[model samples]
Target: MAPKVLFVLTSHNKLGNLDKPTGWYLPELAHPYHVLHGKTDITVASPKGGEAPLDPASVDAAKDAVSVAFLANHEAVWKTTRKLADFKGKAADFDALFYVGGHGPMFDLVDSATSQQLIREFWEAGKVVSAVCHAPAVFYDARLSDGSLLVEGKEVTAFTNAEEEQAGLTDVVPFLPEDALNKASGGKFVKGEELWAEKVVVSGRLITGQNPASATAVGEAIAKALGV
Candidate 1:
C-alpha cells in the first residue's frame, strides 16, 4: 500500500467579518494536493468535520496557467473539502502530516485543541510535520519533550510580513505568523526572495513554505524527506 499522508486543512475563514472577498487561495491547497494526491494515499481533515471555507480571492478569475490548472483538479475538488473529524488521525497510520494554509489557519487552526494535539502527537512519533503559509502559526504553542520550543533553531519559513502587510489584513489577523514564528521560535528568521516569493525551508522532518506560491515546492520537499 502507498504511504498514507494526513493532510489537515482549515474549515474557518479569518475574513469572516470582512465584507471583502476571500477563499482558500487555491494554490496553497491545490498545488500540493496535485503533486502528492495520486502518488500518496491522502487523507483530508479540518478543525471541524464540515466543508472548509475557501478564500474567495483564490477562485476568482485568474488568467494564469497555475490558477487554471488548480481550479480544474478533480481530486482536489472531490477530497479536499472535508471536515476535521471525518479524517481524525492516529499518527502511526500515516507517514507524514501536512497542514495546508491560508489566512483562515491564522484563526481556526491556532485556536484548535485538536490540531495542536495532532501536531504534538505526530512529531512525538518522529513523523514528518509540515505546514505552509499561515499554517505554521499552528506551531507557535507546540513544544518538545525537553521543554524547548518545537521549531527552535530549525530552518523554517512562512507567509512574509510584507505579504501580510501588502494584503492589508495584517492588522486584522489573529496573529502575524512571521512575527510569532520568529519570537516563539527564538531563532532568526530569513527570507527566500521577497514578499509573495516562492520560498521553502526544510530541516529534518519539519517543512514550511513562504507563501501560497511555494506550496508545490514544499510538498516536493515533504515527499522527498519522507521518502515517498
Candidate 2:
C-alpha cells in the first residue's frame, strides 16, 4: 500500500468576543493537500470531527486561479472532513504527519495533551512530522517521556515575529511562533530569507516550513521522506 500522510488541523478557538478570524489558513492547508493528495495517498484529520474553521483573512490568498481551482477540485474538504477520532491505528501507520497553521492554533493546539502524545508516537516511529507557520508552537508543550525537549536540537522554522509584525497581527494572535519556538527549543531556532518566501528545515525525520508559502515545499519533502 502507498504511504499515507495525515494533515492534523486545529478546530477549537476562543468563542465569541474577538472579531479576529480563526481556523487553518486556506493556503497552508490547501497547498499541501494539493501536493500530497495528488502525488500520493493522504488523509485529512482534525481535533474536531467536522467543520474545520477557515481563517477569513486567508480568503484573499485563496482568490487566485490556482487556489480557487484547487479548492474546486477538493470536494472532500468541502463535504467530508475527517476527524482524528476515526483513526484507530497507531502513529506508526502513517508515513508522515502535517499540522496546518493559523491564528486559531495558538489558542488550542499548543496546550493539547492528545496532540502531544500523537506527535511523540509519530516522531518515535520515524514518520516525517511537519508543521508550518503558527502551528509549530504546538510543540511548546510537547515533551519526551524522558523529560527531554522534543525539538531541542532540531532545526525548525515557523511564523516569525517579523512576519507577524509585517501583517500587523502581532497582537491579534495569541503568541508569536518564532519566540515560542526559540524559547521552547532553548534558542535553537533557525531561519532563511524573507518571511514570505518558501523556506523549510529538515533534520533527520522532522520537517518544518517557515510559513504558509513553504507548504508545497514541505509536502514535497514529506513525499521524498516517504520515498513515494
lDDT of 2 by residue, 79-186 (tens): 456877665347867788789888777877778777888788787777788898888888766787788778897777898888889978787776778988888777
Q: By lDDT, who's the top model here? A: 2
lDDT of 1 by residue, 48-138 (tens): 6456677777766343666677666554552455665544457878888888887777777876777777777789888899988888888
Question: Model-by-model lDDT, in order?
Answer: 0.76, 0.77
Error of 2 at 159 (Å): 0.4
Which runs in model 1 stand beyond 4 Å of their true positions?
14-16, 21-23, 61-63, 75-89
**Mind sharing the TM-score for model 2?**
0.91
What is the Cα-based lDDT of residue 5 in candidate 2?
84
Runs of candidate 2 with Cα error greater than 4 angstroms are 13-17, 85-89
Model 1 is weakest, by summed lDDT over 10 consecutive residues, at 73-82
Candidate 2 to native Cα RMSD, angstroms: 2.0
